[model samples]
Target: TWSTDGVINEYCEPCEAIVEGELVEVPPLEEREEFSLDGVTYEAFNTSGGLGTLAETLKGKVRTLNYRTIRYPGHAAIMKALLNDLGLRHRRDVLKDIFESALPATLQ
Candidate 1:
């Protein structure tokens, strides 16, 4: 998603590089009014697969059903800024080129 959406310019040996570091605790969420247009609107958090699975089952039974994407809150904003504000969407090709050049495919 990051690559396709232009949020990330590349993919590296994620499982290896990331797993090498010790797990770090993220600090608590601080309320920020700037993060929202309406307080009710939220980035879909922990709802990605739920929506996919429930979609058909609740199709005609419900008029309004919404599922949020599984995200770590601030992730959406960072992504939105990367994809929308940074104009990466328009420069996906160059972004991909840079990413592919940097990231390793696999290790033996």
Candidate 2:
């Protein structure tokens, strides 16, 4: 799901059927919240990361299955600005170029 080239696909092709069957959808960006772990607080928000497939496979076996992507504070805001405010969502090639150019690969 992640790549050193900065082009990560968030959706799993194998999960598409499960997602459609379950009507799974990502929550609104405004619903994002912060959580603390090891004294560090990070922002998390629901995304189409293929949780529905796992949920469907484990139906009745587990009480719940939820998935979210975690990122540094304000990361979501920047994404919202780029994808919504600047209308980059419809222009993914530009967005991908921006990401590849601005975000350097890190070992950490």
Clash tally, candidates in order:
3, 0
Scored against the true structure, residue 19 in model 2 reaches a CA lDDT of: 37
TM-scores for every predicted model: 0.35, 0.68
Best by TM-score: 2
Q: What does candidate 1's lDDT look like per residue over 1-108, in tens digits?
A: 233322242211011111123221111111122234445444442212233345456555555444334343566566446446876546767656655687654444
Q: lDDT of each prediction vs. the true structure? A: 0.39, 0.59
Model 1 clashing residue pairs (backbone): 44-68, 44-69, 46-70
Shift in Å, residue 40, candidate 2: 1.5
- Show the lowest summed lDDT stretch of 10 residues, model 1: 11-20
Task: Report the CA-based lDDT of candidate 2 relative to the real structure.
Answer: 0.59
How far in Å is the alpha carbon of 25 misplaced in model 1?
35
